[model samples]
Target: MKTHALGRGAPQVTEFCLGTMTFGTQTDTADAHRQISMALEAGINFIDTAEAYPVNPISAETAGDTEAIIGEWNAANPGRRGEYVLATKVAGEGLGAIRDGAPISRATILEAVEASLRRLQTDHIDLYQLHWPNRGSYHFRQNWSFDPSGQSRADTMAHMEEVLVTIDELVTAGKIGHFGLSNESAWGTAQWLRMAEDKGLPRVVSIQNEYSLLARLFDTDLAELCVNEEVGLMAFSPLAAGLLTGKYQGGAVPDGSRMAINGNLGGRVSPRVWDAVDAYAGIAQAHGLDLTQMSLAWCKTRPFMGSILFGASSVTQLEHILNGLDLTLSDEVVAEIDAAHKAHPMPY
Candidate 1:
């Protein structure tokens, strides 16, 4: 796996970040452990998870179970904690399991960090992220209905300042190495950057947004901002919820797969999305590339990509993804992908 700077002055991480949202829920503890070992053995040293994980049926019952699984791996690994750069997120408001769906405030940040530390079995998080903006975000197929017109500028600024200051405290106290955002917009990220600079608070190190062959919303303005501001883009759902894997090309959902677990891939499988997947799959076949690898490698081609987070329900699935880590997409393949994208833009 290739290494890249996480963000400005942040730790270096593998270009591929292992995603663990399936832990504890879709996957059991032993399986999760094996997956971790496989990823680390393959030189992927960056892992990302969320406090409200064990997803595919996120519930109050499995609320921090994913982190707990990692903690168990740490407990068994003994002193190998520093081998990988661990990253996790604090669930945003409306996740009643976490702080009763309260808005993110100074108190919430402090509380969430302590809880995450315990479940992760580590003293500090390498990259602490806000799972979603408190003001709401356009991710998770929410773009069509997202509206910020009702938001108050003063209130938003106040909230950002307070959160930044609290994150600054976490940085100073060694609870977290750096702060990041997930499912955020370009404007929201720019505001955070401006606030951090103006208030001398810690700047955001990364933004975990949904970006794949089917989801290119980040290509225009956010990509430019992330590149110029030194904030890395941590892309999640790189396969468009298994659509790019080609296993679901004919509406076939393998048992225990993400699609089989969460119907419609969290509503990502729109009317036009399947056609887009087939086009990309055709390109992969034409170029002798695995669809999954082609999709992941294409993500790395973006100038602003910090890392691509991929999840696996089984060891075989993980191994399949790791096979693409060393691939470098050629200019011809990239051009074909671009052409296919133009023909079928914004499937989701």
Candidate 2:
């Protein structure tokens, strides 16, 4: 697999970032470790997780279990600790299990970093991200009625300053290599970047937002912001939580599948989504492609792409996606995809 330059101050990582959100729940520790080893063998050098993971049914008890599993892998593979780029996020406010649903504070920054470091069993994190803003985000299918009229610029900037100062301190202390964002808008991302530059703080290197055949919200203002500012987009859910796989074509949820586990796949299921999936699946079959491979390959073709983030509960699924990493789409294939997007813009 080929590598891409991550942002201005970030490291070069593999095109595909192995996401481990299913660890300790849908996937056992042994299966997760095997997947990690397989991903490394296939040239993937990026692994992304969060403290509030294993989220098909996120609970207080299961929280941080994913990172613990990775920490075990790190403990066992001491020599290969630096082989890949390690990334994790500090869960923002409103998560009841962490910090009593409080916003990320100066103190919580240190607290979360220490816990993540302990769970990951690594001396440093290559990328540390704010999972979401304290001001609330329009992501996670919230765009339908997302409103920002209640936001106060002054308060938002104040929080950003506080976090930026803390992150700068962390960077200086070598606890984290870089800072990134998730579930953020273009304006929100620009605010962080601008504040970092004007205040001489650490730069925002990446934005791990949802981008896939079903979710192209990042293609508009976010794309321009990313390309101009040199912030690479670590696209999560490149398959739209398995919607792009065409497995749920006719409301037939396979046993033990994501939909079977969560029932709604985070509200990704709908008649229009199925229609969009059918269109894309037909296009893939027409081009002699598996929808999974086609979806992953198309993500790599985006101009503002940093790395495509995907999760797999089994090594079989990981291998299936890895099989498509090197597959390139033709001009016609891309054109049809764009046409489909225009027809079914936001199914969810």
Candidate 3:
């Protein structure tokens, strides 16, 4: 496994970031612990979780269970917290279970940070992120007809200032180390950067967005913003929520899969997505490779990627995913993937 610099002054993180969204619900506590231990032993020093986790069927009851699971691991294995880079997010608007769908504000951010610290059992979070913009984001398959013209600029700016003030307070209080963003647009990210610079607030160190063979929406503006702004991209779902793994090929939806629980994968289910998967799967087989490894390894080689964020419900799945760290894609494989992208783009 290789390591990459987080920010100009931040610590170096492993190329692959272990995502723990399924830690409590899809995966049992024992299985989650095993996966975490395996990831660490495999040289993965970055772990990403959220305050509102276990999200296959996100509910109010199991909301913070994932963080608690990680907290338990950290507590059991004392003196190991400083060895790994911990990243988690504060839930944004639209999650009914959190703050009753209220938008993130100064007070809400304070409340969220305190709860996350309690759940994680950590004195400080390496990277604290806004799960989504309060002004509404085009992420989570909302770009089809998403509109933000209804949002008032005054309200949005006020919200950003309020949250930044609270974030500065948290940083001063030693509760959070750095700030980041997720599910944010280029303009929204720019606004945060501008405000942070003008007010001397904490600059965002990373942005976690959905990036994979099937989804490249971040390639245009976000990529440029990330490079020039030095905000690394913590790419989530680098396999398109298992679509690129060929597990759901030939219409065989496995039992106890993510699709079985959510059925639509946040509206990612579609016919074109299957077509794209088949094309990639054929290429992987031709190269004597597994699609999972090919997909994850390709993410590591991207210039804009800081860490590839992926999750597994079982120890076997974690091993299978971590194996990708050793498999590097050739120029021919990259060309084939690009050709396939030209043939089938944005399936979901």
Tell me the whole-model lDDT of each prediction, alpha carbons only: 0.90, 0.91, 0.88
User: Residue 307 in candidate 3 has what lDDT?
Assistant: 85
lDDT for each residue of candidate 3 in 31-101, tens digit (9 for 90 to 100) = 99888889999999999999889888888889999999999999988998988999998886867787777
> For candidate 1, what is the lDDT?
0.90
lDDT of 2 by residue, 316-345 (tens): 898888787889999999999999999998
Worst 10 residues of 1 by lDDT: 92-101
- Cα displacement (angstroms), candidate 1, residue 342, comes to 0.3
What TM-score, computed on C-alpha atoms, does each candidate reach? 0.98, 0.98, 0.98
Quote model 2's TM-score: 0.98
Report clash pairs, candidate 1.
Answer: none
> Could you give me the TM-score of model 1 versus the true structure?
0.98
**TM-score, candidate number 3:** 0.98
Candidate 2: residue pairs that collide: none
Give the alpha carbon lDDT tens digit for every residue of 1-348 in model 1: 679798888899999999999898778899999999999999989999888998878888888999999999999999888999999988867466766788888887888889989999999899999887888777778888978898888988999999999999888999999999998889999999999999899999999999999999999999999999999999998988788889987768888788787788887888998888889999999999999999999998999999999998888888888877899999999999999999999987
Off by over 4 Å in 2: none
